[model samples]
Target: MKIFDLAAGADGPEPAVATCSRKACRSEASWQLLWNNPKIHTPERRKIWLACGEHRAWLEDYLQTRGLWKETLALVPDTSSAPIGQDF
Candidate 1:
């Protein structure tokens, strides 16, 4: 993964915000690990999917085996202003 240091005091456009890709899972906490895995994605880019608390483990395993597990960050969908869900 190409890790870049954000310029000092330079908060780039709040990051490319996205919603969970899963339809059955509605909780905003749903997120997938987006990173470079030689077995899956290219090392120079970021990839994402949706995973709720119930599917976190399974998703992690899937990504880990492909060697793409870089970081699991929490996300809040733009549909609501309030904290909609909790991360597991």
Candidate 2:
């Protein structure tokens, strides 16, 4: 439930702490929600929302309802070159 503010990412000194975007769950994030509103944002503009398995789908549905859901990506380790399944 602790959301990392992107404001700390713009020329700031702190690093982004990965956490679930769920309202009440403080679980670690396992997925990334890539979204943007074309009507008010550029095609290249992407906003990110991190979520755990239990909440990823719920968050995606919320964005889909508003036509803002672009893609859902699994959060994996950097050393692994394996691709995540796209069955979601």
Candidate 3:
């Protein structure tokens, strides 16, 4: 299944195509890693990192290594729903 933020707003525009966040991996995104840097973002602020199946672990591990990972959640397709105006 795909992943996204449960807290992410569910009524807005979604991209026609999303690519993995991992460098060099152009696969379509199937997961969304929700995270925040306490030093940089507020408590309610959660950032996103989209990942494909192959790079999911690597990207998550990359965040864990930096102690920036908060959680991982699936992004449901077919709804054309996602937080609008969210940027990487």
Q: For residues 1-88, write the lDDT of model 2, one tens digit per residue.
A: 1234454465543433457887877787889999998998899988888899999999999999999999999986444433333222
lDDT tens digits, residue span 13-63, model 3: 345667788877778888889988989899899999988999999989999
| Ranking according to TM-score, highest score first | 3, 2, 1
Q: After superposition, how far is residue 76 of candidate 1 from its true place, in Å?
A: 1.6
- Residues 11-79 of candidate 1 have per-residue lDDT tens digits of 532433344444566654456566565765567766666577777777778768877777777654566
The most accurate candidate by TM-score is 3
Task: List the pairs of residues colliding in candidate 3.
Answer: 2-74, 2-75, 3-73, 3-74, 3-75, 4-73, 4-74, 4-75
Model 2's TM-score against the true structure = 0.66
Pairs with backbone N, CA or C atoms under 3 Å apart (clashes), candidate 1: none
Error of 1 at 63 (Å): 0.7
lDDT of each prediction vs. the true structure?
0.58, 0.76, 0.77
Identify the runs in model 1 with alpha carbons over 4 angstroms from their true place.
1-29, 39-42, 79-88
Where does model 3 exceed 4 Å of error? 1-15, 81-87
Lowest summed lDDT across 10 adjacent residues in model 2 is found at 79-88
Kindly report which residue pairs in candidate 2 clash with one another: 1-25
- Report the error of model 3 at residue 76, Å: 1.1
TM-score of each prediction: 0.48, 0.66, 0.71
